[model samples]
Target: MYIRDKKTSFALVADKAELDYFHQVSVKDCASATVYSAYCKMTNDCPAWLQAAFWLRDKMSALANVENIKGFHNKKPDSPPKAGEKLDFFDVVEISEYELILMSSDRHLSVLIAINMQSNEGTSKNLTITASVKNKNFFGHLYMVPVRPAHSFIVNNMLKKVSFK
Candidate 1:
């Protein structure tokens, strides 16, 4: 549960005493993409398989009365989202030139997703995604049983689709 080599604002959430689950993934060599643009690519242009996975996830979550997250959109926004705006299912927590932090909370759990961009000597950029969860009840713990592994797989696929320029 610790992320090394990368300094991330995610540490704030990771340090929380109630942290129940945590995962981080990164993609390198994205020289031309900004934090907002990279996020748009990962979400707006989601592949068919990942879209289907979202569908399945929504259906399963509904059975347990968990909040249903909106599926990825095909239309990309012309501008970056602001703090008070909504980005898919998450509320925009903070958005800046090099970082975007989003969150969603419900009766079961609160989830925070942070996307951080690091410039490597001005030649290339690295994108790191960190997901932190805080389970509020038994259902939250149970929900993550399947979600933990699936989250890593899904994020890897999404990261691969992020267009550099």
Candidate 2:
């Protein structure tokens, strides 16, 4: 598959090859994708502290009228999804047999979580969760200064959570 310019972002950890690699492999033997690809891995299942941080963020961002980054539509789900079904929780863009594309956007940036899969055999498979962020303005570029470094660290740890089943 080909990467579109619209999918490009200033993500610190995720790259085009990474996202494409996941998309290429994610369809086989996989029914659905994970949430917060990297963030939840860092915080250990979306802890209370993270929730508090988000609360603060929402309030603060509203003050500046800047939009907060919205990640996965759902943190946990009782079941998998069906194509064309709007996610009950997350700000989803689209869902298909092979991939789950979650999205969020604002004046500063647009983020997409492309949850992909690949299979090695009838029983073996892998999940490639990639986050892509694109800067929308000068402030976005400036804001990424610190965010990029943090993202690199968080994403590295997140990879450890991957399991080949």
Candidate 3:
């Protein structure tokens, strides 16, 4: 997947080798591509580049609090090997990770490991992002800016104005 010069984005589907490394970091992060897409769609605008940025900034700054991951991975064996200890959650599961290429009219911020998957040694396309964001807020904010290319800086400015509000 690749992003064009237009107001659009690409789905970075990694391969098996890349996925292994991505899964390592992804196991900890809470951000999901689906959720991000929905948040961007809320803007009802074009490419959700800016929407993604805002979400990333907020997520990176906020402390990660993930639940059910341990349970999802695999339960430890008890002293007596309790009964009904199976790995069902891991059977049907999904992982979300991506490197958003924020290409604005001027500045282009690449290598943004908001969702891990830092290593780029392999050459496969296993991961994919199905971007279909509708709107961000249920009730849209009048002055709310649409997700654009050059808005990460603006989002940072606003965030700095009110830290963790």
Candidate 4:
């Protein structure tokens, strides 16, 4: 890790890859991180709401004249990401057997999302998902002012709804 910040109450340890991703990102405004978790088969059958998030994101992109050049926004995944694979709404920044890093950027802002799965002592697996955002310009910050809260709400709801059969 390039820089170490105090861990949150959740004690989320940013992995080297995560830190590297952030290190490479340059933001005029603050770079923010938020984490969400769920008890589910994380490597498979990702939550529908999570996919819905991208669908909503695509509409927003259209309004801003950001074309979905990779066509990933509309492609829901049935399996874990491969190293060179494009994911639903973002480019595959990096990936490993246990970690998946996805990123997207426009004139206004850049975002990185990481999803990781680790086995616990019991039946359910622990899924940690983190999102980091960097603003490219003033409008990015202004647009995110209210959207930040809503973003948290959406992530919380998506995580809460994720469950395995």
Candidate 5:
């Protein structure tokens, strides 16, 4: 279903209980691209600024003993990723023609990200990205302090850059 007007809903996600945080952003009139393609382009090809942010995050998170995740890089795949496969830091939970769901869990928290594509009147489509987080401990809650606002900025920037050929 389309995530219109930034409505908060976890209808597409299975594990929705006890979510500590949730956010959604929708982009209108997106260029012609499959749901998988759009998600890959938006995430895999990390911009310089975003990569710098991730680098800082990795270094800081290390103090808490969190595993250093392989930050996003320009590694676009040729085909759709399969369920149970790794898509950067997330695990591909589910994927279809119109939607994709990814999850990542650690000792501190579990994060779920959903990408949905809804066809519009013409060639354009509406693309929405939703993120839900469940904090597993005190560190998880603290980790989100900076990440929460940063998430909004990062998603907005990434969505604006998404343009399919």
Candidate 6:
């Protein structure tokens, strides 16, 4: 974790292997030290919204510390390296036709995810889909699919709460 040209023209240094490990991070790879140093050097502490913008920018910069990997978004490590909220993939409960969202960590992270969702205005993040159950089998199983001609699974990012996290 090297910070080039820090305050007073002081450059910071870190171990190469440590840097390499952090480079290949999942949500779990971020440790307390990483989160602290990653976010501590901020120059702004403005109103909520503006502060959020800066925090996200810092996150992007911190990504350079993480390793690049394909399908990294799709994978969840068994143990979390850092302590923060993360949105887990939606789990489709086969029979219920409803899903359980795997939101872990604190509410702030959930709010962040939901905020990110609404910012896109119904793009990328498809939080919920509208569908009907059909072809119910004798074994009490029903299929939930978009059979209606005009149907949309809209993501109401604003309504989503991160309290579960």
Give Cα-based local distance difference scores for all models: 0.78, 0.48, 0.26, 0.49, 0.77, 0.22
Prediction 5 TM-score vs. true: 0.86
> Which of candidates 3 and 4 reaches a greater TM-score?
4
TM per candidate comes to: 0.86, 0.56, 0.18, 0.56, 0.86, 0.16
lDDT, residue 52, model 3 = 57
Clash counts for the predictions, in order: 0, 9, 14, 0, 0, 4
Off by over 4 Å in 4: 1-64, 68-79
Clashes of 3: 14
lDDT of 4 by residue, 18-44 (tens): 432232211111111211112122223
Worst 10 residues of 3 by lDDT: 103-112
lDDT (10s digit) by residue, model 6, range 1-165? 123223222211222222211111112112122211212111112235433543553455344342211111323443332323432322212111112212212211110110111112332222222221222232112111211221121122211221111
On a 0 to 1 TM-score scale, where does candidate 4 land against the true structure?
A: 0.56
Tens-place lDDT digits, model 1, residues 89-134: 8888889988888888888888888888888875788888988888
User: What is the C-alpha lDDT profile of model 2 across 81-146, one tens digit per residue?
Assistant: 554444532355545444566665567666566665455566555555566666677765655565
Which parts of model 2 have CA positions greater than 4 angstroms off? 1-44, 52-56, 67-77, 81-90, 156-165
TM-score of 2: 0.56
Superposition error at 113 for model 4 (Å) = 0.6
Any idea what lDDT model 3 has? 0.26
Residue pairs in collision within model 1: none
Predicted structure 1: lDDT? 0.78
